[model samples]
Target: MFKKVLIANRGEIALRVHRACKEMGISTVAIHSTADSNAMHVRMADESVCIGPPPAAQSYLSVPNIIAACEITGAEAIHPGYGFLSENANFVQIVQDHGIAFIGPTAEHIRLMGDKITAKDTMRKLGVPCVPGSDGAVPTLDEARKVAAEIGYPVIVKATAGGGGRGMKLARTEADIEAAFQTARAEAKAAFGNDEVYLEKYLDAPRHIEIQVFGDGRGKAVHLGERDCSLQRRHQKVLEEAPSPVIDAKTRARIGEICADAVARIDYAGAGTIEFLYEKGEFYFIEMNTRLQVEHPVTEAIYDVDLVQEQIRVAAGLPMSFTQRDLVPSGHAIECRINAESLPDFRPSPGRINTYYAPGGLGVRMDSAIYGGYAIPPYYDSLIGKLIVHARNRELALARLRRALSELVVDGVATTTPLFHALLDEPDIQAGRYDIHWLEGFLAREES
Candidate 1:
């Protein structure tokens, strides 16, 4: 067990990790930016350090400042929580170099899974089903056309280095492929500093499902079921749920084995997620997230596992007591990302929260650091909190989710709460019969 741990991120996740360390009888050192000087995570940790000013470049994302804080505190390990340096391989290596452990996957595994193309290839090599695409980058327009032709049109040109749906274009025909290929390549270079691109047969109307995996830096790994991250906008997940309504028993079991095998093949450690695209009774691997996820709470809720604690134990080189048999989804759980933004326009809405209230009960869980008079910072992510709920069935879970959301009240600033309100009311959503683009299209129809 670690004597002390440093949290290298802020907000609810930081607070979550701090709580886990406390339970394990480990001390916590929180590193915060000037903008988060009064954040809840800071107030909760055993000790806090101000790394830099408001901007992330000088604070949260700054490797030197964070490592310096760890050195000063004599913290034995670091829990990145999520975002920021959570997925940065170099940061993990730096922590290891400083004689401190990174409470996640090894630096090698992180680097291997960081690149979208390489990760996909590795997954395929491990016998995990992957979206049929080029093995490497499509550097030329002719190569893009050839790949698209092989994949049989309606293919997507995607940036090889990074993907947020920014440098992607759909080509349905020969003429479309040439023009779209040029644009996707140019945009890929501008967005990711890499003009490399790849082609894949676009699976329209697919449900985005991901398997949450935990491993002990060895060959031992198991999955905590799957999360339906189908509700997305601009390739960003807005709502997620565990025990996906779309995947069945056989499919889920197969996916779990595939994910465990994928990570084990890479000799991955700690917690990670293998994202998949499911369409027309088939699943295709998209990529892997080499860090803890914001939607991890849904898996925790149903599986009855504390992912942060597991991450810490794994970092200490402890063997996992839980196995494939131990992972049993007890109930349905859902998470809605309450972001500081507006609908239809997706603009940032940062202002002082004049009033705030969070829901609580048998199954409602809210992960947040904001309170009354807390100003939503313009320098960070827009997510203010997550409203998670669990129940015996999806219908009951949805009802509970609605009640929790209804009980949530934050005044003085516009929020995307209304979006969830409208989303939960949709029949398709309640019936769990929608695809990834379902919510956005539902919103569009309402606007029309």
Candidate 2:
């Protein structure tokens, strides 16, 4: 076991990792930017290091500064919570070269899954189903049109190296293909510096489902079931829940086994998520995230497992504490991502929180790093907290979420809490009838 680990991110997730390490009797070094000197993670960590100025490029994403922080603090490992450099393959290699353990998947696996086209191709060969699309990168407009035509109309053009809904354009018919192809390529070039693009038959009302898998990097792995993340806006997940309202035991067992077997074959290590688009009774592999997801808490709640601790154990070459048989998900869990943003427009609202109060009681968990008077820095993601609730079933979980949301309070700046409150009142959301495009339409109707 490592005596100490350095957390290479800020905000709630950094604090999330710190707590996990603390429980395992491991001291933590929190690296922060100058703007985050007063952040919660920095305040609670056993040791703190100022990596650079406010901008993420100069601080949280600075590989050299992060490495230097590890050296100065004598930390043996780094747990990149979720974003920033968590999935950066180059950073993983550099960390390994410096003899520091990265508490995630190997650099080889990261690089392999980092490219969209290669990931789909690899999954397809591994027996995981994928959406009908281009075999590889379509570099020209004619090639894009051909793939689109073969995939049928209503195809989606996506960047070979895209994520977070960027570098994606939808073509509903032949007339829309040229513009969609050109726009996707241009966006891909600007966002990832890669002009490559591909096409996939777009499933109009598919549900976004993902299976969480963990491995020991020795051809052994297990799956913790699935999370329904269909509530999304602009392709970004807004809320997530375990034991998807639609998926039953038989379906879960089937897909879960397939994902576990696939990752095991590749000797994948640490935490990874195999995301899929589910429509009707079929599942299509969309992409695989090579790092811990932001919605990991809901998975932990249902399965009663500490994923961060498991990540550390695997990185240190320790055996996983539990196996597939040991993972018996007992309850339903839901997580609402609370962001520091104004509703209706969803614009960022960063400022000092005047009053902060978190919901409490059995089956309720609040993962946040903000406090009263903590000035939220505008240089990072607007997500301020995650409000999660667990219960014996989805219905009970929904009731608990409603009560918990009412108890929560963060004043002086607007928050998206109101959005969740409104969602709770909607019949479609209550019955879990929404799909990936549901939230966008909901917002559009609200605005009109």
Q: Which stretches of candidate 1 lie over 4 Å from their true place?
A: none
- Total backbone collisions, model 1: 0
TM-score of each: 0.97, 0.99
For all candidates in order, the CA lDDT equals: 0.88, 0.95
What alpha-carbon RMSD in Å does predicted model 2 have with respect to the real structure? Answer: 0.6
Model 2 per-residue lDDT tens digits across residues 1-448: 9999999999999999999999999999999999999999999999999999999999999999999999999999999989999999999999999999999999999999999999999999999999999999998899888888887999999999999988999999999999999999899999999989999999989999999999999999999999999999898899999989999999999999999999999999999999999999999999999999999999999999999999999999899999999999999999999999998899999999999999999999999999999999999999999999999999999999999999999998999999999999999998989999999999999999
Off by over 4 Å in 2: none
Best candidate, lDDT: 2
Model 1 agreement with the true structure over 99-191: per-residue lDDT tens digits: 999999888888788777888887888998999888788878888878887878789888776666778888888889988888888898898
Listed per model in order, the count of residue pairs whose N, CA or C atoms clash below 3 Å is 0, 0
Question: Highest TM-score: which candidate?
Answer: 2
In model 1, how large is the Cα lDDT of residue 432? 92
